[model samples]
Target: MYPFEITTPLTIDAAVQALQNEEAQPLAGGQTLIPTLKARLAMPEVLVSLTGIKELQSIAERDGQLCVGAGVTHANLAKQTAQYPALAALAVDIGDPAVRNRGTIGGSLANNDPAACYPAAALASAATIVTNARAIAADDYFLGMFETALDEGEIITEVRFPIPQAAYYAKFTQPASRFALVGVFVARFADAVRVAVTGASEEGVFRWLDAETALSQAFSAQALDGLTVPTEGMMDDIHGTPDYRAHLIAVLTKRAVIAAG
Candidate 1:
């Protein structure tokens, strides 16, 4: 790691002010950022730790939604999955026990990793991202690979997921990294269905609208029998090809629907 000043701010205001420095970056679980520093991939002059901000570490119910603080670690979320089984299952399998202990939901979403699990759930559940500036709908939050709609020095306070009638998550992890080679999250409501796929697209996580429409009419694995996932813009890498990922998306979506039922 390069030389950098570490600032532990106790309040959101303090954290935001610290991030105003052009070279300062917010540090959460340090899962991705720390490694980047070690590899000299990133060299921010200041690391503003968000852990000390009390208001950013809460998990509670608010107005018919489950509000999860950005500072909540994956391990912490795993234990609470009984309330949100689909999300819990995804959290339990994130980067193993050690990584889970350190990775934060807010950090994961902010980083917007192409293969990250949280983005799938957030988008599938139609979750709301509450940031320091304003709330952003999940559909508008994720821009592209490792990108988001957050402005400079903006802080994500929490994420709010509305309770759904039924939901499930299915992930095909790359053996080495345990990151999703392709992950699907299916959230079904009384009137609408949402199917979000991650780790498959070149454009990052995106909703599979055709699958959603099919499932909305008949919520079952068989409902997707004739559906063909388009591969035009999917990621092609050493781990998987666009065709392979397109196949995985269908398989995982079916599995998730069956599991959700």
Candidate 2:
């Protein structure tokens, strides 16, 4: 890693101010950043660590939503199996124990890897992203692969996920990276059904609207029997083809719907 100054800020205000330096970067759990630094992919002049900021590490239920702090670790989230079982279940499958122990939700969302799991959860659950500047809806937050609506020097403070009547996340992950090659998250509400697909699209994580419409009308795996997603926009990597990923989208959606039930 290149030589850089590491600052541990006690408050969000201080962290933002520290990031005002054009060459400074915010360090969350460092799961992804640290490796990039070692490879010389990123060489920031300074690193502002959010670990010391007390307000950014918490989990609570408020006004019928689960408010998760940006700094909350995956391991911590996995333990809350009673309140949000679907999210907790997904958390346990994210990376190995060591990575889960250090990876933060904010870090994962901000990085916005095309195959990452949390974006699907956030979008499917209709979660709101809370940042230092403003709150952004999940629909508007994710722009594309490795892209988001976050501004420079802005920091995510919390994420608020509305409790759903039923929800499930199913992922077909790459064995080595444990990143989803094709993943689906299904959420059922009283009025609507939300379905989000990740690790397949070229533009990144997106909702499967047709399946949502079908499932909303009749909540069952049979509802999606003939539904198909176009393969033109999906990723075609060494591990899977676009056709295969598209097929998995339908397969996983059905599995998720059945699992949700």
Candidate 3:
């Protein structure tokens, strides 16, 4: 690993100040950042840790939304399984115990790995990314191929997940890394229904418009029947072929709809 100065900033202002330094990078859980640095993929002059910020570690339900702190860990999610069952269920299905213990919701979304699960939930739920600068919509926040709408030196302060009336997340995990090879999150709200597809999209995590439209109307397993997502747009990798993944999108959508019901 490269030599770097580490700053444990207790407030967002301090952390943002540290990030303003040209060579500094904000450190969340260090689950992804540390490995990226150790592999020599990233070399920074400073590490601005968010661990010391007390406000970034809260989780609560308010105004029909679950406002989760940026520092809330997957383990914390699992521990709160009874309250926010869907989110917690998704959390527990993440990586193994160690990784889950160290991974934070903010860290996961900020990294925005193609196979990551949090982004799917955030997208499906139309959650808001509460940052030091502004609140960004889940639809607008995710860019593409490991990118997001966050500005340089900006910090994700919290995330607001809309409380869905019913929801389910389904994924086909890689046996080793436990990363999603193809994952889908489907939710039904009083106003509308939404479906977000991850792991299977070549463009990155995205809303499955067709499936969402179908589910919004019927909200059933058969609502996804005879539906076809273009294979041209889905990810084709060692895990599965493009056609197979396209099919999985439909299959998983049905499963998630059924689970939600």
Candidate 4:
């Protein structure tokens, strides 16, 4: 790993200020960041650790939403988010025990790995991504693969998920990394049904509008009988081809919808 200065800030303001320095980056759980550093893919001059900030560690429910702190670990989230069983179940299968204990929800969302699971949940739930600067809707937050709306020095403080009437996440995991080769999250609200697919698109996590429209009209697996996602922009990696991922997207979406029911 590259030589860098590590600073643990006790407050959000302090952490933000520290990140303003040249080549300084926010360090949450360090799951993705640490691995990148070891590979010399990232060489920051300073690592501003957000783990010490107490305000980023609380999980609560308020006004019909589940407010999850940015620093909440996968393990903790799996245990605490019983109110949103689908989300908690997603967290429970994130990685192995050690990775689950170390990886934070904020880290996962910020990194926005194309194959990551949380992005699907956030998008389907229409969750709000809260940062030190402002709150961004999940629809606007994710731009593309490994991209987000966050600006320099901005840090994710919390995420607010509007609890859905019913929801489910179905993932086709890549055996080695356990990252989703294709995963789908389906959420049914009072007035709408949202379906988000991850691990399939090259454009990153995206809503399957066709599926959403069909499921919104009738929330059931049978509603998606002929619906299919095009392979035009799907991911084509050694793990799976674009056609395979596209096929999985349809299959998983049906599975998720059935499970949600």
Candidate 5:
């Protein structure tokens, strides 16, 4: 890893100033950034650590919404019962305790690794990604595999989630890493339903439109019967075949529907 100057920014304005300069990166919990640096995938001239900014480390319940600061870590989420139980469940399914302790929501969404859990939660809850400049809806924030709408040097400030009526997350995890091989987050809105799928798509994350439509009509496990998941663009590595993953999507969606119900 290259040696870099580290600057601990005490305010968002200070952080933004550092980030707006060339080859400067904001350091959050360091779970992902540290590894990327060690792997030489990322080499920044300056690191503006956000941890010391107390405003970025808080979680608040306001106006019927749960607004979590971008710096909030998985370990903190796992231990908090005040969060929607479904989101907490999803947090528990992240990496091991050590990873959880260091992984931050902003870092996760900024990285947007295909198998990451935050994208699922953000999509399912229709959360807003608050950036230093503006707030982008989750659907608009995630552009593609490891891509986001955020501009260079723009740092995420917070993520705002409207409290759902009811929601649940179920993931078919890869044993060794505990990353989702296929994870489903099911949410119950007052009038409509939203189902977001992560982990089994070559396009990264997607909405199970059929399952979502089925649940909209009749929210039950049987509602998923006869649904055929398209096998196109799914991963086909040694982990599983495309057809195997397609089949799992249907089955897991049903189980999640039932469990969520």
Candidate 6:
């Protein structure tokens, strides 16, 4: 890793101030950033560690929504988020024990890795991404591969997920990395249904509107019969082909719906 100064901030304001340096980067779980730094893929001059801030490590239900602190680790999320079973299940399956213990939801969403599991859940649940500057809707937060709508030096403080009537996340893992090769999150609401797809799209995580429309009418696996996602924009990598990922998108969506039921 490049020689850099690391700042441990005990509060959000201090962390935000530390990140004001143009070459400074926020360090949450370091699951992705550390590896990138070691490989010299990223060379930030300063690292503003957010873990020292106690306010960012909380998990609570507010009104009808689950308010999750960004610094909350995956293991803590999996254990503490029983109210949202689908989300807890997704957290439990994120990487392994070590990764779960070290990785933070804020870091995952901020990094916006196309294969990451949190984006699928956040998008499907229509959650809100609260940052130091403003609140961004999940639909507006994810821009593209490893990209987001966050401004420079903006810090994500919390994520607000509205409790769903029923929801499930189905992921087809790429065994070597444990990242989702093709993952689907299905959520049913009183007014509508939402289906989000990740790890399959070249453009990154996206809502499967066709499936959402179909599933909204009839929340069943059979409701997805004859439905197919175009392979044109699907990721084509050694682990899976574009066609294969597109196929898994459909299959997993069906499985998620069935399991959710």
Q: What lDDT score goes with residue 94 in model 4?
A: 92
Q: All candidates' lDDT scores?
A: 0.93, 0.94, 0.89, 0.94, 0.85, 0.96
- Top lDDT model: 6
The better-scoring model by TM-score among 2 and 5 is 2
Give each model's clash number.
0, 0, 0, 0, 0, 0
Per-residue lDDT tens digits of candidate 3, residues 132-237?
9999999999998789998889989999998889999998887877988889999889989999988987678999998888887888888778889899977777
Who is ahead in lDDT, 3 or 6?
6
What are the per-residue Cα lDDT tens digits for candidate 4 across 22-125?
A: 79999999988999999998999999999898999999999999999999999999999989999999999997889999899999999999999999999999
Instruction: Give lDDT tens digits, candidate 6, residues 183-246.
Output: 9999999999999999999889999999999999999999999999999989998999999999
lDDT of 2 by residue, 34-95 (tens): 99899998899999999889999989999989999999999999986467899999999999
| Clash pairs detected, candidate 3 | none
Among all windows of ten consecutive residues in candidate 3, which has the lowest summed lDDT? 77-86
Indicate the residue-level lDDT of 36 in model 2: 89
Cα-lDDT of candidate 4: 0.94
- List the candidate 4 regions with Cα displacement exceeding 4 Å: none
Provide the lDDT at 258 for model 3.
90
Look at candidate 3 and tell me the lDDT of residue 148.
Answer: 95
Task: Please give, for residues 110-156, the per-residue lDDT of candidate 5 as tens digits.
Answer: 98877788898899888999999999998898888889999999999
Per residue, candidate 1 scores C-alpha lDDT tens digits across 1-261 of 568999999999899999999999999999998998999988999999998888987888788788999999999988865668788888999998999999999999999999999999999999999998899999999999999999989989999998789999999999999999999999998889999999999889999999999999999999999898988999998999999999999999999999999
In model 2, the runs with Cα more than 4 Å from the true position are none
Worst 10 residues of 2 by lDDT: 76-85
TM-score of each: 0.98, 0.98, 0.97, 0.99, 0.96, 0.99
